[model samples]
Structure formats: C-alpha cells, structure tokens
Target: MFEDKIEKMNENIGTIPMIEYEKRVYTPEEIQDILGVSRTTIYQLIKSKVFHSVRVGGQYRISKRSFDKWLEESDEEL
Candidate 1:
C-alpha cells in the first residue's frame, strides 16, 4: 500500500528519499515546564529578549541555542 507507492515513487525519481526532521524548537509551554515557572513569566522573559524567539502563527518558538546561551550567562551572573 503506502510502502509500495513510496517504492514506485522512489523508482521513478531514481533517488533515495531523504527523511525530513523538524527543527528542534521549544514552545513556551515546554519552557514553562522546564523552568518550573508560569506561562506569564515565560512571556515576560520573551518580552525582555532574555530568550530568542519568533512568533509563528499565534504562538512563539524559542531557539534551543538561544535558551542555552541564556542559561549559561545566567549561571555566570549568579
């Protein structure tokens, strides 16, 4: 069924299909859980640019790199 169709498509294209993986992006909900904080606090941090984030649709996504940088700097500041 699905596998056969994929094989046929691959045969026609003559190239192995590359698996697509979603980029690791963290949502505010996950951040809140990780930091053990409220959503409002997360939003506040985002507003202050403590974490690098981009608005996708109505939600925000924080880059893992940006979050890691913040964590490292915050630790040094402590």
Candidate 2:
C-alpha cells in the first residue's frame, strides 16, 4: 500500500516536470545538521513554536516546507 501510494505520487509529479517535489520530514538531528544548531535548540524552537512541527511518540517531526518557510521569513525579518 505504501509503495502504491509512492508510485502514484511520483506519477502525479511526473506530469508536472517544472515542479520539483521532495516529500521529506526531518528529524531533530537532521534539522540540527541543516541549521548547525544543537538538539537542545531544536527542541527549544519546537517548544517556542518558532516553526511548525508534529510530535510523534515523543519525537518531533519538522516538515521541510515549514522549515523552508520559516527560514525565508526569518531572513526577511533580518
């Protein structure tokens, strides 16, 4: 079922060649690597709701889209 959904999503994306989609959910560790911040900072950001995140089984999952949006907004603020 998962494979089928992925295949269907890929097929849909293939129809729009101009659009590039990366369906990724980042773990806190991965976000830290991307942001060059510590895990504690990541948790703090999650706690402060600096960006959107969903907690699953005591772990927070940050969507790439939200992270990018937050980055863009922060850059504009600066």
Candidate 3:
C-alpha cells in the first residue's frame, strides 16, 4: 500500500528525478565532528536547545535537518 502511494506520488511529481531520501539522524560524536565544537559545548547547546535532539534509550541524538537548516540560515546572513 505504501509502495503504491509512493509510486503514485512519483508519477504525479514526474519530470523531476526523485532521489531517495536519506536517514538524517546524527550522533553527538558526528555533530561534534561536523560543527568542530567541544563535547562540553555540545552538551550546553543540547541543554539550551540551540541544537535539536531526540532522546533514544539513554543517549540524545541530534537531527541532521536542524543542522542543515542552521547552515542555510547562517549562509543567508553572509
């Protein structure tokens, strides 16, 4: 059912190639690597809600969507 819906969506939105969507979840380590921020500062950002994160089990994971949006917003200012 879901596959059929996706196929219909693709047909309706034709002419433009559809790239497969990526799973955009990021770990704290990945976020730190991307942002080049300290682990302490990462925690602060997560705590202050400057970075968007989802809690799973015992770890909090950041969303790649939030990071991409942040990059776009910052780029617009420059």
Candidate 4:
C-alpha cells in the first residue's frame, strides 16, 4: 500500500508542468561580452547611472530589459 501511494504521488508530480526561468540579470563580465566593451567601461557606465542595475552583495547585476531600453534611447540620439 505504501509503495502504491508513493507511485501515485510521483505520477501527480510528473503531471505538473516544469517551468524554467531564463536569466534576465547579467554580470559585469557578461555585459562586457554583450556590449563588446571593457570591464572599466562597464564599471564607468554603471557608476554614471547610464544603465539601470542593482547592486547585490557588492556586485552589480544589469537587467536585460533595462539594457534594451537604453539601447533604444541611444539609437534615438543618433
């Protein structure tokens, strides 16, 4: 009986959809690679508040959404 209950619970769990979340936050190294800029430039931009970012545990994480918005605004300036 216990084995049957365990099997039923496993089946129920399997029926639930497994959701996977994408990484929306990026590190300074990742931003450097994405923007093709140096680490110094990335830090400068962060310090200048040109991009929206959050500092967690002494590290800055930039959101993909904010970066996209910045890109749009920059394009408009040209």
Candidate 5:
C-alpha cells in the first residue's frame, strides 16, 4: 500500500522534483516519517548503533548514504 502510494506520488512529481530542503539534513521526525517508524524505535536504533549519526552544532544528523547502505545490508539478516 505504502509502496503504491510512493510510486504514484513520485510519478506525479515527475520522479525528481526540486527540494527546498535538499541541502539540509533530516531530523528524527523527518527520518521517522521517511522510515515509517515511531520516535522510540528511531531512538533505539540510534542507541544500538544500528545507524550512525553525527552531531553538528548540537543537532544530530544521520547520513543518508549510510542509512541507505544499512538498509541494503540489513535485508541479509532476515
């Protein structure tokens, strides 16, 4: 269901729309929405070091590349 919606949305948006927030990294709330996880789960993943985060000017930012890599490698664990 989610995948179908995502595909349709992407199609409607022409695959690559301009992003106003492209330069800025995502916060926990943004990650939560993107990953379809709860706030607690996001924190747990961060605490367990499953995903690496970096602190910058008092805000922690997750690397999009590293997160994608983790997702790719994580499927093997199941």
Candidate 6:
C-alpha cells in the first residue's frame, strides 16, 4: 500500500521535490574519513558541540553546513 504511494511519488519527482534537510547531514563514518580521525574522536567532538548536531534515535546526525563552517573557523588542518 505505502509502496504504491512511494512509486507514484517517484514518478512525480518534478512536482514533488526532495526535502533540502535530507541532503545536509553527515554521518559519523563520513566525518572520520574526512577528518582522518577515529570514531571515538568524532563522538567527542559531537559531545562537545564543536559544531551543530542532533541525536536522532540511537545515533548522532551532524549538520554538513555547521561542520564545514567550524572547519573553516578552526585552525585544524584538514
């Protein structure tokens, strides 16, 4: 039942656009790869709120915009 609506929605991509917020998130693993850091360090930053993030369900979802802005302002070499 729900699958039919999803299929219909996909077919009408022109009329129904994807949400912008959905594209603005970064996962912990992606952050690790980008920063060359470990999972522990990533969580530490998330906990410290060095950038914007929110706990969704059991895990954290970092904002890509906030993270990039933090990087630009910080002295940390990428």
Candidate models: Cα lDDT each: 0.90, 0.87, 0.83, 0.89, 0.78, 0.91
Ranking by lDDT: 6, 1, 4, 2, 3, 5
Give lDDT for model 6. Answer: 0.91
Which residue pairs collide, candidate 2? none
Candidate 4 deviant stretches above 4 angstroms: 1-18
Better of 4 and 5 by lDDT: 4
Measured with C-alpha atoms, the lDDT of residue 39 in candidate 4 is 93
Q: Which regions of candidate 6 fall more than 4 Å away from where they truly are?
A: 1-22, 75-78
Query: Which model scores highest in lDDT?
Result: 6
lDDT of 2 by residue, 1-78 (tens): 999999988888757768687867889898899889988899999888877899899888998888889989989999
Question: For residues 1-78, what per-residue lDDT tens digits would candidate 1 score against the true structure?
Answer: 999999888787747668898667899999999899998999999999987999999989999888988988999999
The deviation in Å at residue 65 for candidate 6 is 0.8
Of the pair 2 and 3, which is ahead by lDDT? 2
Q: Indicate whether candidate 4 or candidate 6 has the larger lDDT.
A: 6
lDDT score of residue 53 within candidate 5: 87
Displacement of residue 32 (Cα, Å) in model 4 is 0.4
Each candidate's number of clashing pairs is: 0, 0, 0, 0, 0, 0
- The weakest ten consecutive residues by lDDT in model 5 span 17-26
Pick the TM-score winner.
Answer: 1
Report the error of model 5 at residue 26, Å.
3.1
- In Å, residue 42's CA in model 4 sits off its true spot by 0.1
